[model samples]
Target: MTDSQDFSNLSNRRRMTALILLTLTVFAIGTAELLPMGLLLPIATETKVSISTTGMLVTGYALGVVIGGPVLSALAGRLPRKTVLSVFLLVFIIGSIVCTAAPSYGLLLAGRVISSLAHGTLFGMIVVTAKNLAQPGKEGKSIALVGSGLTVSVILGAPLGTLLGQHLGWRFPFLVISLLSAAALLGIMKQLPPLPRSKGGSLKGQLRIVSRPDFLLVLLITIFGTGGTFAGFTYITPILERITGFSSDSVTIILLVFGAGSLLGNIAGGSLADKRLVPTLFGGLILLAVSMAVFTWSSHSKAAAVISVFIWGVAAYSIIPALNMLVLNKAGDAQELASTLNISAFNLGNAIGAFIGGLVIDSTLGLAAVPWVASVVTLLGIVLAIWSVILEKNRKCDRLPEYPFENRTA
Candidate 1:
């Protein structure tokens, strides 16, 4: 083999290694993000706060991500990607450490917010960096691969942390996250190459791109699609318990099944997005709506509920890569800022879905109606997706040169 060919192979190997480290970093971060949910009761008891108040930890973190993502991305505008990643990981480590040592609920909430401030920007940069390092035409796959960490966290990391927290204490989970973050930080500094900053023009220019109708439409789709999923998901445990009449242990097993579905969905979505971006988006949303709709009726039966839940998991996560790719494609030079904004859009969707779900539960429609509501929300996203596609086609056609003979004849 030629020496150049050998060097090319080595370079690919290095990139894969770096990608793996980034994925691991995201796993740690994702685990930290969701860990509080399982430990809420224990944390509430220890901190002398009501369980509802304890739930604020999750809310606060999501709010922090929405508010802090773009702000931090703007602040780090000109910094090297490697430097920004390392700094963000350091901030995450510090926040996790704070959570580990906090003596009161307020302090714990503050630590969660601190950790969350790193979440959006970290994910944005990771997505951008992964795209850059990917082999040609494989950007979608790389993003999916990096994002798989979050799915895996749902599947493995968060559950393991919850188990550890149950045995050791709520603080122990945070402590483990801190250690993981530190290790990831060290790996990043050593294994990752120095990446250049995105050419995301001025902050004002980036904002202009973000405000464009096409981009806004993409964000809307993200918001509605994610919101639709979370609308039912936020209350899935209750739905499983009350409607499906599953035991606590059975619920746990059911969730594992859901996680397995998520992992499979992530892989399938990423692969398909790499090949057919727009179609993947449309199909994913369609499947998501259908799954949620089916879930409404399926919830009454144990076997059917489990089947619907698994399909719901698959449908829910499948659109992520397509949505992310849409942001990158639509944002042009402002990809980094756009990517960060998309992250915020996702978090905003989560808050909206949970809020709407809560409202549905309180109203006469009650818990049984959550799935249908979620299905409707997803259907709205499909409408936006259709509009976006039409606009895209028009834009493409507009770029075509007018034929002089055709114009003369017509």
Candidate 2:
């Protein structure tokens, strides 16, 4: 009996280890996605292109994620999830290698697109894996813990890549991200447990949830809510220099400060969501809108702008984990596809925000106009969140699955 108990204990430990390692892969994916934002200037200089043209890298990557998320997740529906995740990370590694070696802007953009194609699928698989391993009544916190990796990457990866680009050159950042991607691939290969093929039915069954009102509402909330963050952040470096009067060398440090705030926000959002997911989502959206408005006004004052950036980082990120939980809870038994779709929604938000920001900057409105535009969009998101909350409050289910935990671990 003692030996049997010991074996069980060992199994639990191994699963936890695998979860942590998979979370690190989240970090790598997040790093690769955001690093280009900080390195865009150098990339543009090297390619002899305008900054507006360089912005295509971000737009293109986001488009790839939007296209790949649900499609790849559905296509891999019959395969072992662990195998799909491993292959996706390998794709990221290959793409990173191409990015590091690319001789022209066009080639680098292609590499980014290829790498991003794997983003949503990896995150979807990883989140489902995390859920399976979580203790009952703790799904939100568990998934949030894994998702926190992205926030951590923003805090560390973006700034580190920026400094590396400044000192070692732009190509070096991709090389470093490539190494991290390779590490993630090995970890997943060795540690990830096998996930069985879905017994729930075909891809059509999984996609049926997409037509639900809650899912559509949540997706819109994600698109507009997160879009608010990107509209300003896509141009943050320039804003820091042109508006805040910061030197090029100091921008990375400022970003680090923003990242620190995001780390705190991610953890806080997880905790709050575990207690009351709806209220947490509502509060986060409201705070985000208010913060963006202040950021628009504050950008001209260095001290105020720095403070606003920190606040913006916190408010913007605080909604991420909560939003994921909301969608998962709404999807009922079809959690995997819903989870994948949420990641796609986030990336879609990024693309929309970047495009709108570019439009405003290109017009006579200038970069300063981005924050106000973002603020209005965010306020609209707040309305959607409120509607979602009201819809759930009025929901008339005879049974609500006991909050998505009570039976998840099986």
Return the lDDT, model 2, position 399. Answer: 52
Candidate-wise lDDT, in order: 0.87, 0.80
The sequence of per-residue lDDT tens digits that candidate 1 reaches over residues 96-186 is 9999999999899989999999999999989888877787667778888999999999889988999999999999989989998898899
- Show where candidate 2 strays beyond 4 Å: 1-12, 40-54, 103-107, 166-169, 361-369, 397-410
Clashing pairs in 1: none
Model 2 lDDT tens row, 1-410: 21112223337678678778877889888888888777888999999999989988877888888888888778776677778888888988888999999999989999998898888888987787776666655656767788888888877777788889989999999998899878878877887666664455567766776767777998999999999888878889998898879998788788888887787787788777777777777888888888888888898898998898898888888898788877777775466677888899988888788788889999998888888888888888888987876665555344543323222211
Candidate No. with top lDDT? 1
Candidate 2 vs. true structure, TM-score: 0.86
TM-scores for every predicted model: 0.93, 0.86
RMSD of each: 5.1, 4.4
Q: Pick the candidate with the highest TM-score.
A: 1
Model 1 — which ten-residue stretch has the worst lDDT?
A: 401-410
Clashes of each: 0, 0
For candidate 2, the 10 contiguous residues with the lowest summed lDDT are 401-410
